[model samples]
Target: SAKRSVVSVSALAVGDKLPSDIKLSYFDVEGNMQETTVGSLTKGKKVVFVVVPGAFTPTCSLKHVPGFIDNADKLKAKGVDTIGCVSVNDAFVMDAWAKQLGADGKILMLADGSGTFTKAVGAELDLSDKGLGQRSRVYSMLVEDGVVKVVNNG
Candidate 1:
């Protein structure tokens, strides 16, 4: 059975500060593990975050990510300082997926491997019946200076 997401889409309104305690990891250009906080990423900067169900899911691969990649320039033109594609996958998978999509400079591939960030943001979607474990719901958000400016949940 498909279950509704745990995240209260209505509650994450504009001006709400996203949980900063969640730790996210990713592979740097040197392929070494790098750790960062949501606060570090959004503090004093305009950021567009595209959260996905998984790294290589069909809809995410065919449409969601492509949409961001294609419109990255426009988003940046409109003052989006950073565009991130986050998923509950490990850093290696995120890095490889980014490369596969040719997203080198177009999008920042963020890894929330432990689902800590996803759960912290109230976006955790349980799919354990399918053996996939917890994942993030598909959504987009605009954050600035550590506060949410806009949230579009799908």
Candidate 2:
């Protein structure tokens, strides 16, 4: 169950760079918090950012994140510097969800609470009808040295 969407409007392109002003920090498995600034995370690197609508949901918990988790090694082998998972959830929930799905080893889960980063990247999807408020759409972005190369979204 993969969600797909055509690039409508100016959602994202194959050669856009990630905005460097925003910094993100989220909780870890041990309840300790770790904050990651864009400068430190994306400096001179290619990063893959995957977004999910919600955490612990049916499609997400069962398929979406796991798909990336399973394929992370292959992606890395292809020269990806880091793989990140983004969601509308807060740090604690994101932290726990990552561990539960065994994604901690394969991906870095970032909490996009307040949809700050979501709206910033133009990746926010309206799921109010589905009881999901201001959640991120199911999508993935390939970034080269911090510049966006391609964005696939639903």
| Per-candidate count of clashing residue pairs (backbone under 3 Å) | 0, 3
Which 10-residue span in candidate 1 carries the lowest summed lDDT? 4-13
User: Against the hidden true structure, what lDDT does model 2 obtain?
Assistant: 0.81
Clashing pairs in 1: none
Identify the runs in model 2 with alpha carbons over 4 angstroms from their true place: 1-10, 28-31
Candidate 1 wrongly placed segments (more than 4 Å): 1-11
The candidate that achieves the highest lDDT relative to the unseen native structure = 1
Per-residue lDDT for 35-127 in model 2, tens only?
Answer: 776557788888988888888988989988898999999999999988988888888888889889988768898887778777877777888
Candidate lDDT scores, in order, read 0.87, 0.81
**102-139 in candidate 1: lDDT tens per residue?**
88788889999888878777778888988889888888
Per-candidate TM-score against the hidden true structure: 0.89, 0.87
Superposition TM-score, candidate 1 onto the true structure: 0.89
In candidate 2, how many Å is residue 16 off? 1.4
